[model samples]
Target: TQVTCRNSLKNPLWSLIEIPIISSVTCQTVTGLIFFQNDFCARILLLELKWCVLCLLLNEAELQQRSPPSMISLAGGSPNPNTFPFLSASIQVKNGRTVTFDEATMKRALQYSASNGIPELVTWMKNLQKNLHNPPTASYSPEKGQMDMCVTTGSQEGLCKVFEMLVNPGDNVLLDAPTYSGTLTALRPLGCNLINVPSDQHGMIPAALKKVLSRWDPSEVHKPDSTAPKILYTIPNGGNPTGASMTAERKKEVYELARLYDMLIIEDDPYYFLQFEKVQRWLTSSVSVPFPWAPTFLSMDVDGRIIRTDSFSKILSSGLRIGFVTGPKPLVDRVVLHIQASTMHTSSFTQLMVSQLLHSWGQEGFLQHIDRVIEFYRKQRDAMLSSADKWLKDVAEWHSPSAGMFLWMKLRGVADTQQLIVEKALEKEVLLVPGGVFMINSSDPCPYVRAAFSLSTPEQIDEAFKRLSLLIKDAL
Candidate 1:
């Protein structure tokens, strides 16, 4: 298919245009995620969506069982559950309790489920959001309003979808500095102009955001109509590498700046449940949840301007690769559409498994489990801090993590950690991530290094720091 314009010279404004102004448009159907094909540029995305129709049809197939009982699921290609070899399944938790699924339930688990998520699991997640953050928005309504929320293969996928949905070739995007390395990977290849906002121990600086926007002024972004820097991405809770959570006041101020600049906030909070200092308050029988961490941007998003990406990787199980995107109906539904086209849905079996466990635990038991998890990590943090104090106190300085698994350390004399950690530390049998990897400009020198306390034993942490101290001394 081709679109040929015969009267290009007839338009007077075409003579002054610098670039070729749509002289010929190749209007062809592209396979998979390539939006369209053109002669000048082919906007190729990383996601493979060529087999999307099969998944879309499967979604309808899965819905058949939920439909009228009089209807049979002949349209579905789902395998018969009775043919499955497994009879029943039981999973035991650390608390020494087994959640058993009987034959019927096991059969259901073996089958396909909804695209968004298992309905019960999605509901449970929504209730958890209400109990914890309690945004101004209500439930999911696909026909009337937003899809409310949808589960993704991982939180990063959900976040990436938003980036794909909003950003164009030359659009400007705002993000906190010394940010997550994963964030840079997600945004960089999109060809969008990346603007770094200065941050402190309290997270993204509001004054800095205002300053960035003041220069942008919508017009300077080279975007049409609305605001130029439309998306502001941040990791508000237990920031990656830095491990610094935002103060409530900072969140309020940031939200205000977003409102003023007409920007949407994307709060990527994977460590929301892992705050070390806060004691877990038990949720009562009525499914109410209370968290002592700083106010989430979602809580302050009265205008439905905040889209929060949360993960089960930290709190529940990392391998599950399950996470939910919560925000305004419009944006969230768009994400769902992407999910439908790509992964179709998060694994229905995993979704049902997690949902079952939560059902058995209830809200109170869930918080109790979180209490144990926090205690375990707090001990790990303390062990690492103690080790650092004994070995590297004079060589490096670090901020105590209030939550999560990382401690950000700035070497006293080292100018760049790249060669030191990657080359020297590897030889020393000590492994720690160099800080330059997390920076937006990877080639630049960075003095910082991230020390993780998640997996190392106390003795291991102590020995690693001792070797790190030696590495530092040798460098100095």
Candidate 2:
């Protein structure tokens, strides 16, 4: 039996050709027969046949090389196996269960590994993401060419890599007004023009975003050479400095706007699990209500344009330096290639430890841990809110944050918080980040200031607010 192989050639010299597969003969025999039958066109087809055969052979070799280690790899520059010192390692978890990494696991952890990340840890993270975000599609295999995940040193690292991947030096990038200061720092050195989209208590206002994009005139604006923004970076839940989260409806609106404008949405959500709206019921009762994490921008992504970056830093340990990026495969592949050349991989030791911890916790245990964390932060938030009401109510105004670790206050009569930070607040021994730091144009006058209640006790929060209130009063 013969199978038909069709080759579509669009070159001006040739057209499509259909050839029957000769199962009885080699590719070389087929090529010779084609060349004998037709002149130039047959030669082109024969060359294509040879090229296809070569590709098949190369692919087979790669598959064999990547398969289980049956033969020693003398071709590559892998580190010597015997030189590694660690034999085994162990750690104790919260529930008094101890997890140990044996010799085999230790070897994988210590040595150089895949650029994307360790398979086991990536799989666990992918599963966790599926359970939490419930994305449009779930993809575990990069070979499938669908949405995939890659681990980074932290979400910060992921953000930097993504900016490098997407933004040219003179390109314009959109950000929420009063964005994360860290993001400003990251993008400043790249020479990309930063365009601030107006935001409200519900995060980036969809209407404002649409207006900015619709009215964008490159020639009339300051940066004439810069192109229109191709990306919008946002922290959907409890934005840093702003402490505002977009509602589900708002996220859908923004997602639709992104589609309309033809742009990518970078959702940097480290505080997704820390939302405090339902914490009271979860804290007061024994039975856990399903974790009420806000719907992420990724959940609304129908075109796979949302790149969601998450971290274990806030929920687990900041020192862990582990985060994952979930997005379309092409973007993730570029990030992986960058990682391969740059950091090589996030700390294998940290990846191993995090993987073990997640494995031990399971889904239920993980939810329980987040609940405990939220309860703790909820108390601090209450303390801050109460203190603000008591001491700063007349002088400053702020919206109560529903998630993450900040209170963004707008003082009534202040022109800029930077002057207060430098001259008044510091003198009064109240350390808070000035709002200008979070602005796209840092030199602009800003009355807002970001105060974090994450690390302070109730008494301490009260004291800090009292001091801050006094400073604001004196400034007024």
Candidate 3:
């Protein structure tokens, strides 16, 4: 007897062939007939076969998950939970004010929480972004292209996730020349075609960007078939390495170009609060004044094209690994998805700490804290600039940065600073980051070097510049 089966073959577990039963009387045939006659045995057989097929399918699906035991992984996303040992913490602020987290807050931090972040902390960040950037309009709904925020381990992590969400292999990415080395490190492995837009003292030059975009020739690129650059990655305020902040007018021009080119702008402005002019005035005068902040790309993002990443690393503590991304809800949602699958969320304890600090400070207090920080760094900037003027004025030229940490110097007569740094600067006990490392084409000759004054003492700044001057003169 033949049993008719309507096997669509769409499900791989089941076979399309029919089974025929015969009345022949062999021992094996008799056993088979008995098993076939029992519905339970037949069902068991089908289930076992399905299980075997499922195993095979799963094995085929995840080749990377089945990596050999000998394969060592350097690509880990989650930090070891053991490192965080604080059950509770208290921070003292100005005016004898102390903010402390109790057991309840500690418990919430120790245990798992929402993927987006701690809700209260997220609200604080959203308010901060709103007050700081004053984005032309706002929305929380992704469908409406409303702005939203997501907490990240750091701004660097947000940057990595953004690149992952937006860039495919061989996609074009626009970057300000002398870009952050960290940005290059995050994007290089993705195989992106990087186009460098030249920058001046006021960050990315809008006219240069316009010319590059208008005359963009795909044939000139290594990958002609790649899509046109849809993203511009910039460090708008006190740009890393270059230490050039975009003026409000420059930001407006760049924003217009982004609109004209239909591109998304990634504004990684970690040093926004560190702008110095108003802080200098407040420090010098007897009366305190509000800190003046430059207009951010987000302020001009009428079309929701700017994704701004900010960090506590510069303002607060670097070890906290706390930062936030503010942008259109859809893009932020993607970042949250990536976070959920990877680090899960930024540390709840860290978020709680930051939130408590902000709450105690209120808007005025927060502004005051940043003003003090800016004043501290402004002196350092002054020290570095003074040393440069005294020691190497004839040998090197640089624009005194209005914001951020580094002093970018163009060394006269040197073709590449990398060799000088390796052979001479280190030998002289003075160290600096070669400007070539920050260039889009690392092989290109760069006469520049970046000197950071954020951590060094005034004496160290003067001594380092003196040594660097000697090295430059020797090379010449």
Candidate 4:
């Protein structure tokens, strides 16, 4: 074995590596040492999934660590975890089952973890990606069109960082209209120019998207055209505010358009697991994932151009603040660098807790849990629908949500919902978000209102819309 330097001189882009037995893979960098376990399993001799980050162009320094029997590891700046006062820990699940964290686990959780994440959790999520969305571009090579993922504080952080990494200050990015207010809040402050693409019940319309991008010739897209935006941001499945999922045809067309225009797509799909109630039969006891869940942009991604963020907040505990970013090696590497400099990786304990849950549940158990969640949300959505029909049928028009928690309601005979929702609805002891906040120009008058069905009871929902109908009448 050549010990280290396993093609370091020639393949400078491969900036990261993993253990011989350990199967976790993440893009560490192009400048740092390329460590390996022995000669490294060529199968697992992973590549640097390229990061589209602010280049940390280090001088070509040849660095690699390889195991030589029992070699003393003196590298890395992590503090000794043995010094921490906390020892064992445990938390009981909903069924009164305890998931204990022993000394070995506590040491890792209480102490500092790698910027990418704890290795076990990283491996688990990567495998989960394979199960959930067998992305076509799934590869470990440091070559172009490689996919990699990193856990984040929340999907929002991952989303925001990726947004920051791709969007230049003046670059006009294609953004979905009436998007998540949180998205508008996160992106608008960055000062990047946005080109709004209209969306209907089926999410972002391809026709509207094409019309906007038609400003510049499609042939010039693959070129380095400064004026043309190279990014299209969307939440295709169970989208926020709108609560709509893009049709399968639109998803295909959107991916093709992105290919044609050479544009990178950011798929912020937090509500993916919340799709309409449909039982997904598991083919295996452990891991035979044959697309039980709905298809994703990642599933169709052949060019490694999509950077998708999935959240645990909606399905699991929001306080846990755990999520993942999956996309091309280069762009994800930038997110890793940003995470290192920002929150210093998501809370290690939370990551471990999630990992522990997954380990105990296995893939089948985890998906069953998701099925329960989907059914719960479906009930909630139906309740809201029932209430809306009973109370506000004539006053508000809305499409039944395909997934997620929110209902987007357009009031009849109302020019804008701001004054009605803010002043009148509040006076009536009812609260709803005015749709203008989700707009690029939040100051403009908007006729729609967003209502969340996740928390309220059927009776309360009925009463709220009853009051809302009265308010709409008053406004008119």
Backbone N/Cα/C clashes per model: 1, 0, 1, 9
Name the TM-score of candidate 3.
0.78
Per-model root-mean-square deviation over C-alphas: 8.4, 10.3, 15.3, 7.7
lDDT of 3 by residue, 68-175 (tens): 868664543334445657567677866688878776666656655555667778898788777666786474333334688888998999999888767666667899
Please write out the lDDT profile of model 2 over residues 1-476, one tens digit for every residue: 12233332322211233344333212332421111111212321233343332111112222333778786444445576568999998888777978789998787678766678777889988777776667764642332224689999999999999876666666678999989999999999978789988888899998888888876653323233325576889998999988999888888888887666557789999888889886222322365466668778776665667788998888899998998899866468667756765787898788988888888887778888988998999898999999999999999899999999999999989999899987777788878898998998889999999999999789988998899888888888
- TM-scores, all models, native as reference: 0.84, 0.81, 0.78, 0.84
Model 4 agreement with the true structure over 66-100: per-residue lDDT tens digits: 24547554544457777899999989998555789
State the weakest 10-residue window (summed lDDT) of model 3. Answer: 52-61
Least well predicted 10-residue stretch by lDDT in candidate 2? 31-40
Reference-based lDDT, each prediction: 0.74, 0.74, 0.74, 0.75
Stretches of candidate 4 off by over 4 Å are 1-83, 222-225, 277-292
Return the lDDT, model 1, position 241. Answer: 83
List where candidate 3 sits over 4 angstroms from the true fold: 1-87, 93-95, 139-141, 216-226, 279-289
Count backbone clashes in candidate 1.
Answer: 1
TM-score, candidate number 1: 0.84
Predict model 4's lDDT versus the native: 0.75
- Give the per-residue lDDT digits (tens) of candidate 1, residues 120-224: 988998887887776665642322222278888889898888787666767678888888998899889988888889887778888888888886564333233
Off by over 4 Å in 2: 1-65, 139-145, 216-226, 279-289
